[model samples]
Target: MLSVDNLVASYNAGPVLQGVSLSVQAGEVVALLGRNGVGKSTLLRTLVGLVPSWNGSIRIDGTPLAPIATHDIARMGMALVPQGRGIIGKLSVADNLRAAMRAAGSRPALSIDQAIAPFPALREKLPAMAGTLSGGQQQQLAIARAMVGRPKVLLLDEPSEGVQPNIVQQIGQLVRKLADESGLAILIVEQNLELALATANRCIVMAKGRIVHSGPPDEFRNEAVLRRHLAL
Candidate 1:
């Protein structure tokens, strides 16, 4: 479980997240949607402690996380697969996965085979250099790396970006499986509305650093609601 209460953050330009609030429960998947510069990504960064919160609180399983170190946050049962698929290009696929398992500390490490089970393509590319893989493969590696951490809450920032349509669909299925089977609470920041709606059980739309709308995926069926909040 995760809770963000009136969360606020700012960059050099000015405040980017202002009094944003939301929550995710175990086995639940929530989609964060908005136009450019609406603080969707900043919220994820703040949750992971990559960006400091200016105000408000972030709690995991009822434990406050805002003042903790980024690594400490990860150790507390949260993992982030960032937008760019931050894989270690020089490392082999297997090595990348192994490194993440080690970083998970006391949590049970997912074996290489188990980690790549959802991503069969990664099985054959175990010895290949991560940088040598296509964007989609690299994305799979990113998610696989996070999976090895055995996180209670997974924060995904634009998992579908730069991925092909087929791969995007696979990513959605994988997310659903993770939540349904693993009971992992997930928050996905996505520009791809279709993927967001397809994967998330509920949707939250943000604007100018605050949440303006929250509802089930079916809310998108109303053209006015979709356009008013997401400008879709």
Candidate 2:
């Protein structure tokens, strides 16, 4: 339900994203894969209006998104779980989630209990300070905060980064469940090729800030494609 066309973005005269184009259909999980500095995160940021699009069009369910404020894009049903798990360190877990819901302009369909059900460990840490949680717990909290918005399209940037193996699996399962059960379109920028292939039906590979390959996840599983575009 999201489409980006011929997107070009740069920072301080150096191009970061060059004419990147891609789309995500409702209920589909599209994995964005690239080596370091390929602009996968830049594309995600540009899509959500965090970065200005120098040249391109972004449409969400037919609504055009300009180079406007991030909140404005979020209000239109897109929520981003940024790479760093951008949570307020001092805020209670509950408040952090509530803030995300307010930012999305709606109360969450899933209650804190229900939302944390997917990550049972988070349920017990409701009153804890976000900064005090483990990295995995913090990542789960970040996803939980995004879920509190009940978004149509969830943009996740490197959810598994720095997370332990078990928690990464948990996050993967939750991501797949969100797409399958809730019909939430997911565009994930991930460095972990195996995790992306396991969770996503489709994969888009970027090289030097442009899309080089887009196809079924299985198709991208080839050794040659991995070595050429993704393996670092």
Candidate 3:
């Protein structure tokens, strides 16, 4: 479980996250959606310690995580699949998975083969350069790599950014499956309405660095709701 309370963070003293508070319980996938410049990404970055929070607390399973070290956060069972997927493009697919496990500095929760089990495409591309894979494949590698650590809380910035529609569908299914089967606590900031609606158990809308709306994914299906909160 991940809990953030009154989290306020800034870059160079200009506040971005203003008292943002939210929590993700085990087996829950909470989708964060809003227009750009609303601080969705900043919230995720602050959670992982990439951005410093001037106030509030972040706790994992009731354990406080100071906004100081990213590595320490990861080691404490929090993994991030950032906006760009952040894979080592030059490395082979298998090597990418190995690198993540190595970075953890201990035995990973899942072996390389177990990590790649969900992605059949990735299994066949083990020997190929990671850079050569499509954006969708690279996203898969990114998720698989993060899973090698068996994080209790997973933060995904945007998993369907450059992928095709069908692949996006697959990813949505996989994300939901992971939560259902492994009880992973997930926080995903997704602009793709379909993916968010299909994958998340609930949706929250962010505005000017704070949560303004919270509801089941179906509420977002109303066009008026989308236009009112998301400006779509």
Candidate 4:
């Protein structure tokens, strides 16, 4: 569903992703794993055009995406739930979901009620201000908001970070459901190895801004592979 070839990207100081390449098939979940500051998030941002690629090509479906703006990328069926949840703090839960739907430029296949079904806590809080929610609740809101867009490929950056264990597990289950039932291709950047293994069908490990390992989830369970590419 998505393919990236020899992707390179950088900020003012220097490059953060160098010659990275990967692909996500339809209805598959791919986990992007790495220790802190290894450019996992940068690669996602570059793919969706939030950060411009210095070199390389990114294609969604069969069309090149390198020239599109980030908003255009969303219209092309990609949704990003960034690291911080990126929720509009002052907006009500319903408004947040509505905004995402509007931004995507189409009615979501999953309605707001259905999107929040997996997150029961969020359902009761739809009228509440997003800023008033706890970290876990906000994370749920973020995921729900993304679901409201009905993206073909969902890019999630550390959805488990700062969330409670129970909520994290719930999020993992939702990720699997999205891939299995809804046929959404998921690319998640996660530091939580257990969550990644449980949620994603494949794993890509990065080090020093390059992919060091790319294989099925079981291949990443090897002690040697984890130590070499992701050990802190």
How do the residues 146-185 of candidate 1 rate in per-residue lDDT, one tens digit apiece? 9898999999999988999999999999998899999999
Better of 1 and 2 by TM-score: 1
Off by over 4 Å in 2: 106-110
Positional deviation of residue 192's Cα in model 3 after best superposition, in angstroms: 0.7
User: What's the distance in Å from true for residue 74, model 1?
Assistant: 0.9
Q: How accurate locally, in lDDT, is each candidate? A: 0.91, 0.86, 0.91, 0.88
Q: Which stretches of candidate 3 lie over 4 Å from their true place?
A: 102-107
| Segments in model 1 whose C-alpha atoms lie over 4 Å from true places | none
TM-score per candidate, chains pooled: 0.97, 0.95, 0.96, 0.95
What are the per-model C-alpha RMSD values against the true structure? 1.0, 1.5, 1.3, 1.4
Tens digit per residue, CA lDDT, model 2, 134-207: 99999999998888767889999999999999889888988999999989999998877778999998998899
lDDT of 3 by residue, 1-232 (tens): 8999999999886799999989999999999999999999999999999999999999999999975598888878899999988999999999999887744546456788899999989888999999999999999999999999888899999999998999999999999999999999999999899999999999999999999999999999999999999999
Worst 10 residues of 3 by lDDT: 100-109
Model 3 earns a TM-score of 0.96
lDDT-superior candidate, 3 or 4: 3
| True-structure Cα RMSD, model 1 | 1.0
Candidate 2's clash total is 0
Which candidate leads the pack in TM-score? 1
